[model samples]
Target: MKKVGSFVGDWWRLVSPYFRSEEWPYAIPLLIGAIALTLGSVGLEVLFNDWSRRFYDALEKKDEAAFWREIMTFSWLAALFIAAAVTRYIVSPYLRLRWRRWLTGRYLAHWLDSRGYYRIELERTIDNADQRIAEDLRQLGEYTMQLLLGFISAVATLISFLFILWQLSGPLSLKFIGIDVEIPGYMAIAALLYAIVGTFLANVVGRRLISLNFMKQRYEANFRFGLVRVRENSEGIALYGGEQREMDMLNLRFADVFRNGWRVLFTEAQLTLYQAGYAQMAIIFPYLVTAPRFFAGAITLGVMMQTASAFGQVYTALSFFVNNYTAVAELRAVMDRLQGLQEASDKKPATAIAVEPQPGGRDIAVEAMTLALPHGQTLLADTTLVLSRGTSTLISGTSGSGKSTLFRALAGIWPFGSGRVHVPAGARVLFLPQKPYIPIGTLRDAVKYPDEHSAASDGEIVAALETARLGHLAGRLDEDTHWTNILSGGEQQRLAIARALVFKPDWLFLDEATASLDEVNEAAVYDALKRQLPGTTLVSIGHRPSLRQWHDRRLELQRTPGEAGRLVEGAAPA
Candidate 1:
């Protein structure tokens, strides 16, 4: 009961936003139209129930004229019912689509903001976020439409049919211990009790399904993700001949899926047996109970049939939750997953990188900066460093000396740290890591990205490509393809340098950006950069001996005895 209460509360919290969002103009009208159509459909059912009694009575009387009149009545009722049903069918999906659109946009924005995607990965706060956003959101939208319409229909039918059953059932007289007693609406009362009992048993049989469904979703997504990873890295695996190892890992993941599938099948099979029996019995239970009165001549044949029809409608309406238990469980799992993603995205970092703007400043300064890994191991303590604007500085350190980590801190992305990083106000800064991100798009779009394709003129783009010795790609700017897979390592790196030239930021930080190129080609690229972006502040992390001559100053991360590394000044060898 407690778990059910929490699920209801969380579902409402997750769902109420769309109705209140900026898209309410469409959402509100579609919702109102769908609901109105549902109520009208219920009214048509009530009319049909009346028509059934009249048609049967006409048959009993052997009257052809009255029979034809009732047939006409039914034809009109069926036509109206079809109209109501079809209109609702069209409008309900529109409502669902619009709601999903609003919700998908919001979730994507929140997940991408504040580096939430990156932070969630570093901390492992949530698993399968991508799947939750893409797949589970779609499920939520679909289930929400079906469940909402079903609930409304159930409630309305229960109300409309309860009165019909009561009027048709009349009264039943019973003897108990030599005393006589009469019960009104006996068939209606019987259906109420039957539905209640069935619901209780179904809940008892199916209550464990919610948590199982949650884990099953996670495990399935993990298994699928593993296969996708293999597909993306198939080249590397083939080169290393690690097919057997990959197969073993994949099999291990699939075992979880197989094991859980059996459990789900077992539970569903049990529930299905009970549900099938319950539904079949409902078809005849109404007749069995009310036939005694009919045989005794207390009611006519038409009354008996009307009574059975009304009883069926009432019972089915009351059994709504019992019939939809599995769907409810699945919806609960999706809602909980989405709730976890939202909570993880909203979490505040324990440590933050403080970026301060210095007015009229010419240098980037780090004061009392402390660097720590995500696991809380300190890398650098109380490190202070400065890089003047329009000057070339190279950062050299031993392996694993927090060189790339420092660059992340300066970029205001590494959050497991405390420090003040002051940059010149209004200065544009860009960071280029060794493996730069190459989005799947046209060559022109990839070069300008993080920028629109039209951000740079054609002449400027051509000039930057020529300077980086990537003139071969200039003509292919408008051609759409996955340039990442098509370009070689050297070409990709050169394309990244060309991006820097096109963007022309005031400060550029390179973390082994040119490591893939030959020494001569690397030198030529640097010389071209110097000629093109003379006013840009260049800070680089490199290990090659040939890189020292381009930079005027150098800094190194030196180890201290029994303590973290410290940043200090250093000089290049003559």
Candidate 2:
């Protein structure tokens, strides 16, 4: 009971928000209409059950006129049933689609907001959040509607038919141990007990399905992620001749999927076996119990057929759980995954670092700032530095000496740290990494990316490209393609430089942003930046000695063994 309550609570937490949201005006009416159609469908079934009794009686009596009358009666009932079913079919899926759209938007916002996606990656607690948002939410919306409406219809049918079955039940008299025992509503009692036993057994047989389905989704997502990695790094893998290694790794991932799939199939088979037998028995069990009265002339043929129909409806309603155990299990697994994502997104991490904006300030300050890796190993310890306005500075360090980590700390994204970073309010700062992200779109859009609505004119963009040594790409500014694949490493870096040139940030931090370019091209890019944006503060991380001429100040990260790196003001390395 507690588990059930908890499940309901979790489900409500996920579902109720949509109905209460701004979309509720549309959502509530669709939901009520779908539910109304469900109840109407159930009402139609009751009318059909009554029709069955009259039709059978007319057939038994060989009354042609009465038979035609019931036939006419059935025509309207069938027409109404079909109309309701069709309307529900259209309305229900449309509602589910809208619900799914709203949920997708909400989850996307949560995942992308406040760099929640980055934090989740840093924590490594959630796996394949893409799948959770895409596949799980889709299944959640469909399954929730499917199961909710089915359950409601089942309950309504149960109530409506249980009374009819009770009235038709009469009494069952039996002699047991020399005592007369009379059972009232015997058929109803029999159906309730049968469904209870079936449901219990189904639960026992399919109890493993929920966890298995959960693992199944995980394994599938892992396998897909592996495939995507191979596609994204196909060039590197081919250069290394690592196709066999990749194939082996992918096979292992798929093997997890395959093994879990077999377990699910076997579990489902067990449940299906029991359910099939139970369903077939239910087809004849009604006649078997109610036939004795018909043979004894205690009831007419109409009553016997009606009793059988009502018994079927009542038993089906009571067996709802038994029939949908697999779907229920799947829904539970999806809910668990989505709930995990929701909670993770909502959770605010308690980090020691505080990033604040200083209004009307001219410099960026790092006060007693310390940076650590995820495993608690110190990267930079108790380092205080100030990046003054209108200065060009270069940061250099040995490989793995936390230069980039310090950059992340300044950018207010490195959560595994302590201390404070104060940036000037409304300051436009840009950090360009080594391999710039070339969004799969036009070259103009790529240059103006991270700012889709930049006010840069086409002429400015083309001039920036020419200045960054990408003059050849000026003609293809409007050509839409995967820019990452099309451009070489050096060209991609130049494109990023062009983007930086266009944006003209007050503070520009380049983390090895020109590592791929030749010395002449790199020099040209820097010279262009100095000439065009003379007031911009340039902070760079690079080991190349040629980079020294571009900056007036140099800071190196110095570290002793087993200690965190510290920023030391020094001359550029010869």
Q: Name the TM-score of candidate 2.
A: 0.98
Candidate 1 versus truth, CA RMSD in Å, comes to 1.8
Candidate 1's displacement at residue 399, Å, is: 2.3
Total backbone collisions for each predicted model: 0, 0
| lDDT tens readout by residue for model 2, 322-408 | 999999899999999998888777666666677899999999998988889877889887878899998788999888888888878
Candidate 1 lDDT, tens digit per residue, 1-574? 8976897788889888898888988988999998889888888888888888888888988889999999999889989988887898899988888887888899988898988888899899999999999888888988887788788988999999998899889887787456598899988899899999999999988877888888899989999999999987887899999999999999999999888878888888888899999999999998888888788988777787788889888988999988998998889889989999999888878778798999999899998899988888888888788888867999888878788988889998888989899999999888999888999888887888776744698888888888889898889888898787688788889999999998888999999899999999899989988888898989999878788888988888876534588877877555
lDDT accuracy of residue 563 in candidate 1: 56
Model 1 segments beyond 4 Å from truth? 176-179, 559-563
| Model 1 local distance difference test score | 0.87
| Residue 170 lDDT (model 2) | 91
Error of 1 at 357 (Å): 2.7
